[model samples]
Target: MTATLTGVDVAPPAAPAKRRRPVPGWLAVVPLLVFTAIAFGVPALAMLNGAFTVKDQATGASSYTTGNLTASLQGAYLTALTGSVKLSAVSAALGTLLGLPLAQAVVTSRSRAVREAVLTASGVLANFGGVPLAFAFVATLGNAGVLTVHLHLTDHGWDLYSFWGLVIVYLYFLIPLMVLTIAPALEGLRTQWREAAQNNGATGVQYWRHVALPVLAPSLLGGLVLLFGSAFAAYATAAAMVGSAVPLVTLQIADALSGNVLVGQENVALALSLDMVLVAGLVMAVYLPLQRRSARWLA
Candidate 1:
C-alpha cells in the first residue's frame, strides 16, 4: 500500500544542478600558451638553427655545421664555462648559508615591526642588481674608491675587478633572494611541532637536527638552485665591473656577438646560449623535484 505524507517534500531538492562556467577551462590557458610560444619557443628554435648554421662572408651563403658547438667547448670558451660554474656554485652556497640564519631570525622574532622592516629591506635589496649594483660596489670598493682609499683597503690588496670581488657583489643580491625564497618555508614550521618536541624532553638543537632540518632540506636545496641559476645567468653587473677580466660564459657570448675579440663569430654566440640554456635546464630539473617535495611537507 502506498502512503503519502500530508506536508512533506522528499524529492532530494533537485540535486542542485551543477553550474557550468561561462568560458571553457582550456580557453583561459590559450593566452599563456601563445606567449610561451612567442617568447621562449621561437627564440629557442632560432638559437638552435643559428647554432648549427654557418654563413659564408664571401659567398653570402649559409651551411649547416656542428663546428660552432665544437668551438664553444674548447680553449677560452671552456675556461669561461668552468669559471661560471665555479662562481655560481660558490655564491649560491654562501648565500644559502648566510640567508638561512637571517630568515630564521625573521621568523622567530617577537617584534612584528622588526620582521617587517627586515623583510621589506630584503625584498628591495634582492631586486637590486645589474648596473646600479656594480656602480655602488665600485664606488665603495674599487681602486681609488672611498673605502679603498680612506680605509687603506687597496693597501690590503682589495681589487673590485677580481673573481672574488664579483662573488662578493653576487652575494649582495643572492643572500636577500635566498631569504625571500626560504621565508615562507620557514613560516610553515608548525608551532605544534615545536611544542610537541619540547614536551618530549627534546633540546632546541635536537629538535632542529632531528625534525626541522629534515623538513627544511628541500626548501634549502631549492633556494641554492635558485641562487645558482641567478649567478649563472648574470650578465650586466659582471660585464660592467669585471669586464673581460673574469672569464664568464656570458662575457664570452657578448664578445662572440659583438666581435669584441673576434669578428664573424655570431653563430658561436648562439652555441654559447644553447649551453647556457642546457645548464639552466639542469638547474630547473633539480629545482622542480625539490619544490614539489617541499610543497608536500610545508603546505
Candidate 2:
C-alpha cells in the first residue's frame, strides 16, 4: 500500500498537433497577377489606345479616333485576316489527319526500339526550324531542287512558294506537334479495351469510330487547336518560303513593324491590334466549346 503511493510516471499530453499555418493563397497568385497586369493588361490597353488614337506626325499630337480601326477593317488588311483564318484551319485539319495514324503506329508498336526511333526522329524534326528547314524543303522541292533536277518533275510544274506550298511547309511543323500531343492520349488507352472490342466482333474501323475516337476526341481536338494556333502565329517559315509575294497576316505585321512600303505604320498598328482581337475571340470560341465537351466527357 505504501509502495503504490509513489508518484506515477505519465507521458505529457502530445502538444496539440501543430496546426500548419494555412498558406496564404494570395501569395501564390500574386506573381501571376503581376505578370498579367504588366505583360498583358497594360500592353492590351496601350494597343487599344493606339488602335483608336491618331498620332500626328508633324504636330506630335495624339487624339482618340475610330478612323484607324475602321480603315484596318477594309482593303488588304481584311483580305489578309481572312487568309490567315483559312490557312490556319486547313493546316490544323491536315496535321490532325496525318498525325492520327502516326500516333497509333507509335503507341501500338511492341518494339521499344521502333518507338524510341520514331519519337527521336519526331523530336529532331520538330526542333528543326527557321532557315535550315526552309532551305531543306527548297533543296528537295524547289524548281531547281534535287527532286526537280533528278526526276525531271519540273514539267509537272510543282511550286512550293504558293499558298499550298506554305501549307505543305506548315505540315512539317504540324505533324510532329500533333504526334507529341496525341501520342499521350493513345498511350493512356487501356489495352483491355481493344481486346474486348475485338472479342465482341467489332471491326477496327468500328472500334475506332465508336470506342477509341470518343475517348480520344478531347485530346485530338485540343491538339488540333494547338496546331491551328501554331500555324497561325508562324512567321519565319512562311516568310522564308514565300516572302512578300504572299500576303500573310504575320508578313503584314512584320512589314508594319519594319515600316514596309504597303501599309502605313499607324494603319499597320491598327491591323495588328485588329488581328490580336480576332485571334483572341477565335481562341475563346474554340476553347470554350472544347472545354465544355471535355468536362462533360470526363464527368
Candidate 3:
C-alpha cells in the first residue's frame, strides 16, 4: 500500500582499483649494498693499497711495489700456506670419515635418549674452542698430561704440541661440525626410500652406495669444505698449544702485524688479504660443484 509513495533505491557497484603500492627493487637491495660497501669493499681496497705500497720510515711516503706479494709467494709464508692447506685437508677428511658414521648412528638409533645425548654432546663440543679446549687436551695428552703417565704402560708417548696433536684437537671441533651438518642431511632423508630399497632386497651397503650417498653427498661435501676453512683459519688453539713453534699462516700473519718488526705491518695486511683470497677461492671451488649437484638432485 505504501509503494505508491516510496521511491526506488539502488547502489552503484564499486570499481576494481589497481594496487597503489609496488615493491621497490633497489630498496630491496639497499641493505646488502650498504653492507658490501662498508664491511667489504672499503676494507678490501685499503688492504690492496697497503699491500703494494712501501712507506718511508721517516716521511711516511708511499710507493707501490710488487716486493711484498713476491716475498709472500716465497719463504715462510709459502711454507705456512702449504702446511695450512695440508692440515686443513687432513682434518676435514678425517672429520668427515668419523662424522658420517657417527651421524648415521645417531639418526638411525632406536634409542631417543642416545640420540638426544649425542646431539647434546655435539652441540656442546661445537662451541668449545680457544684456551679451554686446548688446555683440556694438554692436560690429557701433553708430555706431563694424564694420558702420558699411562702411555708408558703401552710403550707409547703423547705430545699434544705437535702437528698430529693439532689434528687430533681439530678433529674434536671438526667432528662436531660434521655431525651437526650431516645429521640433518641424514634425518632429512625420507624413510620411504630406505623401506623401498629394503623391499627390493637391497643390502645396507648397496642402499648407501646408490641411494643414500647420492642424496647426502651435497651436505657431506659442504661440511668438509666448512671444516677445512675453519681449520685453515684457526689460530687460537694452535697458538695456545704450540705457539710459534709451529707457524700456522694465521699466526704468522698475526706475528708480522704485532711483533717487534714495524716494517712488516703493511706486509702483514697484504699477507692477510692473500690468505683471505686463497681460502675464499678454495671454498668456492668446493662449494660450486656441491651446489650444482644439489640443484640437479632437487630438480
Candidate 4:
C-alpha cells in the first residue's frame, strides 16, 4: 500500500460484477400455452366445426349449413336457453350484491385469522359443485329430506325441486366465488382515498357514491359477468339435482350428447355450445377492458 497526500492509503479497485441469468421469458409461459391449446382451443375448434355442418354417415359426405344453429335457437331449445340466461342473471346479481359486503368485511377486518379463514373457505366453497353439492342440498331440503322431515316443511308447500330452491343452491357457490373476485378489488382501494373523503365531511353513503362506487363499478361488473358465465356452464350439479325436470341449456346439451334424442342432435349440441361460447366471449370482451381500467387505480 502507498500513502497519498501524506494521509491514509486507499484499497485497490473492486472486482467486476457478475451478470445475472436472463429470465426464461416465453419459455416460462409455454406450459400454460400448451395446456390452453389442449383444453380450450381443441374443444372450441371441435365445437365450431361441428356446429356449422351435417355429415352423411353412410355416404361419408360433409356439408356446411346454419341449420343446426337455427334448430338450436327455436322451440324448446330456445326456451331452455332463455331459462338458463334468466337463472344465471338472477344468481349473478344476487351474488354480486351479497358478496360485496362480505368482501369488504374480509378486507376491513383487523384480525389476520378472520381474513385467512374467510378466504380459505371461499376458495373451497367456490369449487364445491357437481354431484356431491347437489346431493347435499337435496338431502338437506328435498322432499322428506333432513330439514323437511324434522320441520314438516312439505306441509308448507315448499318444493326444493323448484326454480327458487335451485337459486338458493346456486347462491352457495356463487357468493363465495364473488367474494374471491371482489376481495382484491376491495383491497386495491387506497386508505388515503377514504381518508380524503372523510376529510371533506362526506358521509358513508356519500363517500361510496362519489368515490368508492365509481372505482369499484368495473370490478363488480366483471365479477357479475364471470358469475353469470360460471352458472351458465355449470352441468353436473344441475343435472344431478333436478335432472330432466329443469330445462336448462346444459341439460339439453347433455341429452343431445347422450344420443337419446332425434338425428342431428350431435350438431345441435355443438350449436348450443357455440351459442354459449359467443355469450362467454361477449362477456369477456366487456370484462377485459373493465379489468384494465380497474388496474390503473390499483397500480
Candidate 5:
C-alpha cells in the first residue's frame, strides 16, 4: 500500500478530457457552394436557356431551337472564332517564349531587391490591361503617336490597329503573367538536382535538357495554357484598340448583344458565350492536369 504525502491532497482524475468532435469538411465548403450557385450557376443556366430559345419577330412567341448554336459556327461567326483562336495562339506562344527567360532570371538572381522589383512590376502589369492599357499603347504606338513618328515605324509599315498589334498588346500583359506563374516552379527546382547532374559530368545545357526541362515541362505547358485563356477571353483592350477590324469572337459577341450589326441577335450572343465557355473549359482541363503533375514534383 502506498503512503499519502503529509501536506498534499490529490485531485480527482479530470473526468476524461472531452474529445471535441471534428468538423465535417463538407460543412466548411457550404458557403463556397452557395456563392458558386448564386454567382456562376444561375448565370450559366440563364445563358444556356437564352442560347437555345428564340422568339418570333412578329408574334413575340418564344421557342427552343438549335439555330443559334448552328449560326454561331457558320460564315462570319466561324471566321471570328478562328481569328480569336489564332491570335490567342500567337500571343500565348510569344508570351511564353519571352516570359520563361525573364522568370528564370528572377529565380536565379542573387539580389533580393532585383527579384522583388520584377515581381512587383509583374503583378501590377499583369492586371494592367483594359481601356487604360489600350490608350497607353495608342499614345505610344499609334499611327501619329510619338514612337511611331520617332522610330519611323510607319515607314516600316507598322499598324497598331491591326491583328499583329493586338497580339503585341496581349503580350504586354501575358509575358508578365507568365513570369509570375512560372517563377514559383523555377524556384521549386532544387540545387541538389543540379549537383547530381554535374556529378554525373553533365554540362549546363545537358542538365537542363535531360533533368530540369523534364521537371519543368508541366509548369511551362501550364503557363502557356493560362496565357492562351487570357488572350482568348480578352475584350476591352482589343475593343478599344482594333475595334471591328480584328473580327474577334469577343467583338462579334459584343455586336450581337448591342445589335450594332443586327437587331434581335441576343440569343446568338449567348451562343457565342457558350462557345467561349467550352474553349475555356478545354483550357482548364489541360491546365488542371499539368498543375497536379507539377505539384507532385514541386511540393
Candidate 6:
C-alpha cells in the first residue's frame, strides 16, 4: 500500500509491541526455602514441641507442661548452663583479642606464601573440633602425655580436664575461627582513613582508637557472638576430653538424653536444648542489627 501510494506519500501506522508480564523473582529461591524448611525448620519445630511436652511415668500419658523447663532452671542444670555461658564468654573474648593481631600481621605481610599458609592453617584449625581435637589436646597435655611427661605439668597441679583447661583447649579452634571471621573486616578497612588521620597530625594509637577499632567493633562483636555460639553448642570435644567432670550444659544435656543418672530424662534434655536455642536466638537478635550497621559503613 505504501509503494502504490508513494506518489501521494501515504504510509500505514506501525503496530504496538506487546508487553510481557513480570515474573516473581522469589520463585528462584523456592528450592532454598524448601531445603531450609526441611533441614532447619522441621527439626527446630520438633525440638521446640518436645521441649514443652511432658510424659507421666505412672500412666505413661503425655501432656503439655512447663515442668521440664522450670526444672531446667534449678539445681545442677542451672549451674551447667551458667558454666557453658561463662566458658563461651571467656573463650570468645580471648579469641577475639588474640586473633585480631594475628589477622593483622597476616594482612600486612609482604609474602603471599605466608599469607596463604596462614589463611589455610586458620581455615583448617577453625574447623578442627570434636573427638580428634579433644584427643590431640589430651595427648599433648594429659597427665602422662608427651608435654606433661617432659614438663611435669600435673606435678604443678595443671589438670587438662578442668574448666580452665577446657578454655585452653577451646582456644585451639576459637582463635583460628576469629582469625577467619575478622580478617575480611580488617581488609574492608580502607587505607585512606589512616592516611587522612596521619595527615591531620593524628598518631598511630589515636588513628586506631578513633578510626580502626570503632569501625571494626561491630564485626568483632559479631564474631565474638559467633564464637560464643560455637563454644556453647560444642559437645564432642568437651565430652570426650573431660566427660561429666566439667559440668557443661552440653554434657548435662547429653547425660539427660542418655538417662545414665536418671531414668526418663530425655524431656529435660529437650528443655535444655530449647534453652540453648533461646540463648542463641537472643544473641543473633542483638548481632544482626550490629552486623547491619557495620555493613552500612563497609558498603
lDDT, candidate 5, 1-299, per-residue tens = 33457866666555787799999989989999999999999999999999999999999999999999999999899999999999999999999999999999998999999999999999999999999999999999998889999999999999999989999999999999999999999999999999999999999999999999899999999999999999999999999999999899999999999999999999999999999999999999999999999999999
Quality of model 1 by C-alpha lDDT: 0.95
**lDDT of all the models against the reference?**
0.95, 0.80, 0.81, 0.91, 0.96, 0.92
Q: What's the residue-level lDDT of 282 in candidate 5?
A: 99
On residues 1-299, what C-alpha lDDT tens digit does candidate 2 reach at each position?
12234576555666777778999778999999999999989977777777878768889788787887676667777677678778889999999999999989998899999998988888887666788878999999887889878988767777888888888988998898889877877887777888999999999899999988998888788888888888888888878888976677777777776777553475556556666577957876886687566655544
Off by over 4 Å in 6: 1-22
Assess every candidate by TM-score.
Answer: 0.91, 0.84, 0.84, 0.87, 0.92, 0.92
Per-residue error (Å), model 3, residue 249: 0.4
What's the residue-level lDDT of 184 in candidate 3? 73
Which digits, one per residue and each the tens of the lDDT, describe model 4 over residues 1-299?
A: 76789799977788999999998798999999999999999998999999998888889799999999999999989999998999999999999999999999999999999999999999999999999999998999999699999999899988888787888889999999999999999999998998999999998999999999999999999999899989988989889999877779999998898877665589999999898889889989988998998888777
User: What is the Cα-based TM-score of model 4?
Assistant: 0.87
Q: Encode model 3's per-residue lDDT on 54-108: one tens digit a residue.
A: 7777996778888777766677777877788898999999999999999999999
lDDT of 6 by residue, 149-212 (tens): 9998888999999999999999999999999998888888999999999999999999999999
The deviation in Å at residue 233 for candidate 2 is: 0.4
Which residue pairs come into collision in candidate 2? none
Tell me the lDDT of model 1 at 158: 83
Worst 10 residues of 3 by lDDT: 1-10
- lDDT of candidate 2 at residue 153, scale 0 to 100: 72
Q: Give the per-residue Cα lDDT of candidate 1 at 245.
A: 95
Clashing pairs in 5: none
